[model samples]
Target: MRQGLIRLHCGVIEIENVSKRRGRVTVLDGVSFVARPGRVTGFIGPNGAGKSSTLRILLGLDHAQEGRALVDGSPFTALRRPLTCVGAVLDGSGAHRSRTGRAHLRWVAASNGLSRRRVEEVIELAGLESAAGKHVRGYSLGMGRRLGLAAALLGDPGVLVLDEPFNGLDAGGVRWVRDLVRTRARAGGTVLLSSHLMSELAEIVDDVVVISGGRIAARGTLDDVTGGHGSLEDAYFALTSS
Candidate 1:
């Protein structure tokens, strides 16, 4: 496994007063938070609390009706060779079912002008070598998640925006993700992990942002936000209940 040089250009993510609406439903209302470089920031919220919507806006997959999401002070869409700057895994698989894992990654690498060597490197990093030749449709949910993670690392990105990255993983896989996120942050990369599992977030995140009803309920370092609540899970329940 080749540990690449630390890229110094990774930037902080700033989401300011962003609001979004889907038809008549307001999915996000004044949602704001920051994922600083060299830290794992946890974005926690219940289902329908707009976590996914907020991530979509940040990735430039969807536009907000108000406010803005910026990466290193610029919109994601404006960046040249965006993948080299930020890597994202918004959902499951992110690949066609008929394609083998290797083929799926090869296409992404080709599109980004990344070398086959880089793809192989990420395959090893993601522990997907054994299953690399299998079609995605035959993969278990855990395998698919690993494949998505492999794709995300293909760019050796400075910033990682992963939504529910731990989903479908067994104990070993979960530990792998936890260590990987920590390693990335320690190397000066920014990581924003959105998940509903408070226990998992507590184990990895340096900062926590809690959302409820499309609004920011709390934001700060884990200790600051937990604030005598005993645990992140408790703090989250208390904050969202209010």
Candidate 2:
């Protein structure tokens, strides 16, 4: 099977035959794929299909029972000054509710040895200027997401891992994120994001990796993965339903 092997290159996201279990129930079964630079890769899957599990392992937030997840050809934890190489937005802002958005970003910057100026830069980049001073608890869902994106951008990293990046976003916000990630990819950044909004994903993803039942159902460029299908949605349902 395609997933039984892993071919890794320097400066890309690589997952090699990773499997995981919660007690006896398998969450991932030899899940493997790569996200290359200069393109956007969309990871799509139905709920409980192991999308989050794989990403968590990639980010070093979880351990795998087998196989590996690597960033830039090395395990994530082995990278010195990792934030400067990879930035991630997972599970909302990950900030204390009592902290103001600006405070949260400043704290992240300080922890990462990033400059305060960079924090402001990302705040503007994320369109969070007006809301930066508000406590995270008072921020709207979209505002919280913006804060997370802002923090993720603080290091100006070359790789981005985002989950549900379009969640809580309006049409305009979605368009903003699409443009942002496309620009990043155009600048030779490796962009990996997972989202359930297939239509929005189809607009920005250069490649697609679909997961079903904890394994890769499809992995290829958008055109190849969507072959003969009416749309990404059509291809997704057809692939997963089998």
Candidate 3:
């Protein structure tokens, strides 16, 4: 984890009063959350609760009509090398199916001026070395996910924003992601993960931010958010069902 050794000057993610309107539909209304360095912050919400929208705005892929999304006190677009500052895996395969996994990673590395050695390192880190030479079309969902993660690690970024990363993995893959996330946080890197798997999130997340109806329903440390509830799942149902 050479990238994990890189010092994060300001790795905290602060989303303040972020609101978005899409064709008269308010996707996010006054949403706010904070993810600190060396912690795994779980972002959870129901479908259409604006989780994806918030991430997009934070990454500078989409604009927010109101409020601000800051990474280490500055917007993502302001960074000199965005990839090095933050690595993200959104909700899909970020590579072309026709291309080999290695080819896809090589192109991404070239785009970011990353060395071929770095790409190879990430491939091994992501456990894609065995299948990297195969075309993406033949790769399983878990393999594709590993490839996506390998690309994200190309820059050895300080911040990781992953959405539903455990969607299509076997038990081993799940454990791999869990260990990887924990390792990153322990190394003083910030991690913001969004997933519907309450059980898994409960196990690994140190803090959580729950969004409901385009607004933040609750935000705090795992114990704080869970309160007196028997489990995180119970608390989630209690908050979102209301």
Candidate 4:
């Protein structure tokens, strides 16, 4: 529950005609989609289909050979107070194993000028209350994920970019992430989630953008994309199997 208050900084994610190449191997080819406020856009594709590549480009972690990825109409690297504008959870917790969960969060908060109170708030929200004092080195995969999510929310950001967010989670953790992302969208925030978990993605996503072979396969509302299939999973196979 987000207290029924809309986040004022809700942002739009626009990835337009983005293409990337690594040593003559195309990673993405003319991939384009938009994740607007109050919507959870699922970016679903098979392994090596460029889901991570596109997100990395959107986060300014890699260069796109052509086109552009924009957050709130500006490139991610060009944004002021970047973390405040977008909170991302990519790969893993991203916390150093030697540091306690709280230490890692506090460090990030301090660097971003975020208050310690905010860090604690996110820790609570992420259900890492008891684990906060434990070193990340000992945390389980689910715990590390919670820590990553907690760090992402420390800024109370309006835009969230998550890649395989459901990985390494139990049923309860899955529900936790599902509810959290839904709550954020309901609060007028924008979310772009990249995952190959068709069933899970179908539950919380409002829009669907399917990519394959380093290119876009389909894009539309959930119902629109799954209309002719038995379910999102069936549609996913139908769309990407070619």
All-Cα superposition RMSD per candidate: 2.1, 5.4, 1.8, 2.1
What lDDT tens digits, residue by residue, belong to model 4 across residues 1-242? 55323354448899999999999899999998999989999999998999999999999999999999998678999976676778999999999999999999999999889999998899899989999999999999999999999988888888999999999998999999999999989888899999998989988999999999999999999999999997999999999998
**Higher-ranked by lDDT: 1 or 2:** 1
Best by TM-score: 1
Clashes of each: 0, 0, 0, 0
The local distance difference test score of each candidate is 0.91, 0.88, 0.89, 0.91
lDDT of 3 by residue, 129-151 (tens): 88999999999998888888888
Model 2 / residue 60 / CA error / Å: 0.4
**What is the per-residue lDDT of model 2 for residues 1-242, given as tens digits with 9 covering 90 to 100?**
22111111324999999999999999999999999988999999888889888989998999999999988668998976677778899989999999999999998999889999998899999899899988889988888888888888887788889998999977777888899899988877889999766988998999999999999999999999999998999999999889
For each candidate, what TM-score against the reference? 0.96, 0.94, 0.95, 0.95
lDDT of 4: 0.91
The C-alpha stretches of model 2 lying farther than 4 A from their native spots are 1-10
